[model samples]
Target: MTTIHNGVSPRAHAVQAAAALAASMGIGRFVYTPILPLMHTQSGLSASLGATLATANYVGYLIGALAGILIPGVVRSAAVMRTSLVVLIATLALMPTTHDGSIWFALRLVAGIASALVFMIAVSALHAHLRGQSQFLAGWGFGGVGLGIALSGVLVFVVRFIGSWGTAWLASASLAVVCAVAAWGLTPEPRPIITPDAPGTPSSHRWFTALVISYFLEGIGYIIAGTFLVAAIDLAALQWVGSGAWIVVGLAAFPSCALWAWLSLRWSRPTLLLVALLIQAVGIALPAVIGGVGPALISAFLFGVTFLGIGSIALAIGAHLQFPRAVALLTAGYSVGQILGPLVVTPLLRDGYRDALLLGAAVVLGAAVAAAVLRFRFPSDLDADPRTATSTEEVVFDVR
Candidate 1:
């Protein structure tokens, strides 16, 4: 086992991990959402094309996640983390150089892959370095994404004055550079060597199936709202309302993981997750049905609050299952759902974002149903060590 450097508390390492996620997952992977409207308003990018670009990024994320699962050695490498961070910066910087949609798609794809590598490396490092530390530290670390979102939202708002989308991309990359520098000294623990579970009939673990299915459905449901929520607001409400909503999301999300972790101590993970999914469904649908600045802001707040919480609780349940590579498996399933989300809703774009929001709500409702089933079928599966709830849940999964 490896310990953090002398004088560097485990909490500091957790902060470093959070900063890495803020840069990679929040800024690198998600800065796109705030930027999408800019591209459409200024660059004449169509909604269908924007959805295609989002899917391209999600595909890259899925590929990157699969690599992490299949090649653990690579995921644990410090060199890989450093390289991915640099490449992610480069990809963002490159975005401004090209106006071609194909080129933009390729850049987003590469950014997605680089962001995943940085995210997985940062998270795995936290698990190793922060061992035996309070799980609340991990919660704060996860809050980095919301912080990054807020930062990027503010940047984009500044861009509204500057009147250039390119500057927003460049500024976001600079922030990533700062994060990379801060996290450069962060060290990863030696990868754990685990004995493989003996082969058995897969059907014996019905609960695992339900968990993965619910997580997968969550992937599909949450993303449509995440990717389009700001864009929808911009179109339906005031121009500033979209970016303002995104900032609200960031503010609400900052403390959500820690709040959810605290709640998990008293409530079962399944019940907590089910409740989150149900609330998130309403959040996702609110803007579509209600139609106003208030509802838009409320949607952003509720969506931001629950999306991360659901991921935390669901993956925590995966850890409780004690399956080999449980985290990796759930990640893969969730990634697939993300890839499918924008693509599944592309046809609905012709009808407008309201249809997409409604579709997202329906899928999230399905996810809630799955969570309810998990709770009913596996009542005792929610027990977790009071001190450790698998910080893997803390990773700021973009569009989760």
Candidate 2:
């Protein structure tokens, strides 16, 4: 394991990374879900415009991901992470100041970009500092997103009774500020020095292609639910049920990565990935098929548990493949899919969110089918060159 600067313990590093994720991913990016209902009833935000705003954010996320890939140095800079955190905070705070849809879109777009940068920086830091630590440490760090989600959900749930959508946005921004303070000292991963390499068995490109396709499909399916699940539940359940379900989602998600990491020790990543997708598909479709608070909460729980787990497992598999720029390529594909998710289901939104959720469920099943393809003749043993194998192992750990 690489030594952390200033004698920061691995646990402390994970905590900082988690705080960054909580602020950037959980509060900044996803606070929209619980707040969407308020926008609809309180602010006259139509379903079409809502979907459009969501798409704008995803587009911005793709751009940010591309920037990280193109300029690798930015991923290693604490300044970049801090700037993104500030930008994210500003975006959330500014959201309530205007009723103009265009301004909302722009704010969300910029927030998406900042969220992506924070995510990349936090993940890089976790990978660098907790290299050989228990996978549970990284899993707990990822759970920070869940913690943020739960906290924001609670905020919105309370504000819905006493305030308006603008209040929700402002409160979320305040929460992000608190998280940013905790993450202020986080260190980005240092750039590695390249050394002469030894020959090793080349990873199977065919499998890598399958992995990419599966992950891309997952991006589409996951974001649809992430954006609209609360709204969908609100359609059929009590007024409080929607936000309550969202809170359930956050609670379920908080420990999901750690659970998945523990399971990965006993099961192959591909198998676990496939199972998770299948479970998520069922969760997404549950409320669509059955209407009520029970189904809605259950759906939230299942979706929350699997979404982050899927990402962690998929990225770990990409690292194991040892393909060149595999993480970047996979991330790009996933981002593009996220950009398409809302647009692909926009037409369905006119009827209601149910059709959209059903569509999302089907797409996730498609991703699972793609994952199943990876189970055949998969390379479980990599007894190749020791140096190459060690590097791959480090990547897998980092990804987890």
Candidate 3:
């Protein structure tokens, strides 16, 4: 008989967690990218304002991440997740009801906070319940973000022909409602029994600092593409091409974490991290350097394949270091990088998205360089706990 926890099977819990991720991350946070073009054309939102809005959302995400780290109780509470889901849906629904830019900014900001909370709670649940299960199950759960992205992209793509940006937001809200229902039964991670650990040699700060710098750079570079890829593609490609490419990105991302996780079993993570970042840099620059329907789609695929995987590898590396509050520190650095991404590129946006994308690619290459530094004399065997051997694999399977 299948073991049940609080009336939900482990498989069922994973499914629910996936649904929650799809709702909060895929639809709640990312639907903005596809809808951005519509707002530009129909709502008359300026490029600078759009960048500001994106920044606001990132700021909110940082706040939410910090909250989870500081409170501890929040990540363990089902009520927090439920409330965040409701708030997320509310933000999406209210977004279409106003033409005021400040309101839009506030809504996106709240949505960001809610997205972070939902994401943390869902991930915690997975880590708690899915222990000892096949790592593939966790990968699939993380892929929920990609699934949500694809669904929202399809919704916006169809709405482009028939409705305004408002309609797109409303439709996305409805889709989120469906996902929320599916995820409603998800259980929060139960609190763990506390135990002390054996003392060990201190981790090398030099390598850890290199890893932080690389991951921080990754945050800046990836968010630029994440926020503007569709818009950038729309500039040079056909009308359908932009949204179509986003769909491709989502589809490619859906299986990417699982693929990366499986590969880590064979290759060292630092090697894989460098490889992923280098490929992502190429993907980010492809559309800018070579504009065409083909290049856009190829660019989308490459980006989708690596962005989440990079986060997985970087966090796993942090865990291996066993730095104090490593996950929180890395997450904070990443969140700050995300907030800075759009602002750094705002001046470039005045011309078009091309210059911004080129800059983003350059930053990612910088991150790859840092990753290269980390690989030199990396302490892959730093953690002597045999029980923690799978830590790298577990972290790699999770989406950021």
Candidate 4:
């Protein structure tokens, strides 16, 4: 019989969780970035339409996240995860059948909802299953998103050489299905033990508020870059350059969480978050300013390396602060920011994606400043014993 903490192997659980993230969050949610340019060339998809579709997906993600928080039993069940995986696969498979823009929007919106359920469910289950395991194991599990990104990027790239836009979506669906099967048995983790907070006592309100603001800002900045980096590179450089850069982003992101987790042992989480945001700001700007393959690859590397690490550290910090419903709160804010990312920059696309990229960099810089302020305000936040934090508090995987 299963208990709150069980005898599952951390490595096995981490690998399975990573596979789930790669399928649902990476391929299901994000395979669109690399494929958007293809759609533009072959299917007459305009930049404005693409941005609208992205916003639709973000809206769905917000709705799905809210569902997870409100319908706790459903989101926590393995059946939901399996159902989400099937829905994600079906969305990808169905994308090629529709030529209408509204239909595409509807497909992506459903995909977004499915992706969020798979991501949150997997993370919640894995957190419980991996309890008492090395924190590094958890970090490795989060790297699955990066792995999925890389795999999907490569699939799109290869299909571009031999196939059309529809083929790319189909190929991505096939890959996602395979990953879903691999992760099938890892779910339905034992229900976590809950410890109620003392009534009338809130912990670290100032620091928590600052962290959420910074994370929300980071979500906006990161999505602009994440959603459009490939298209931006395609406009400036060779077609292959954009896809190659995306692959680099995936490769760099795969190990980043573990690296940041290791760094957390020595540095404060806020300090690491600030530094990562700063690096990401520069990274997001490089493709716009440099416009060459070398600079584009560097930009991808920097973006990948920091984005996941920043997320891991920020969630960990939330736990440290003992913030109630911290993950749910932060995720909702972040999803809202993502919805705003494309809509905020729609007017700028008439000029070119360079202005949008620069805007992303500026927002990230603002996020860095937020992190710095938080660091200064609560220098001792990291000194709290993380071991005392409830497992339920240790929620979220950097699924993007």
Per residue, candidate 3 scores C-alpha lDDT tens digits across 1-400 of 4567888887898889889999999999999999999999999999999999999899989988888877878887889999999999999999878889899899989999999999988987876777666777777888888899999999999999999999999999999999999999898877755333323245567787898999999999999999999999999899789999999888988888888989889988889999999999999999999989999999999999998789888887777776655666688889999999999999999889999999999999999999998888888778433224121122122432
Off by over 4 Å in 2: 1-4, 195-203, 383-400
lDDT of each residue in 1-400, candidate 4, tens digit only:
2233345566777888899999988799889999999999999998999999999888888888888777767556888899889998998999999899999999999999999888887887776676566777778898899999999999999999999999999999999989999999876555555565412124478788888999999999999999999999999899899999999999999999889988877977788899999999999999999878899999999998998888878877776666777766777788899999999998999867999999999999998988887777564634444444243453465321
Cα-based TM-score, every candidate: 0.92, 0.94, 0.95, 0.94
The top-ranked prediction according to TM-score is 3
The lDDT of model 1 is: 0.81
Query: Candidate 4: where are CA atoms >4 Å away?
Result: 1-8, 198-203, 377-394, 397-400
Q: Which of the two candidates, 3 or 4, achieves a greater TM-score against the reference? A: 3
Judge candidate 3 at residue 208 and give its lDDT. Answer: 79
**Candidates 1 and 3: which is better by lDDT?**
3
87-107, model 1: which lDDT tens digit per residue? Answer: 999999998798899998998
The whole-model lDDT of each prediction reads 0.81, 0.86, 0.86, 0.84
TM accuracy, model 1: 0.92
Flag the better candidate by TM-score, 1 or 2: 2
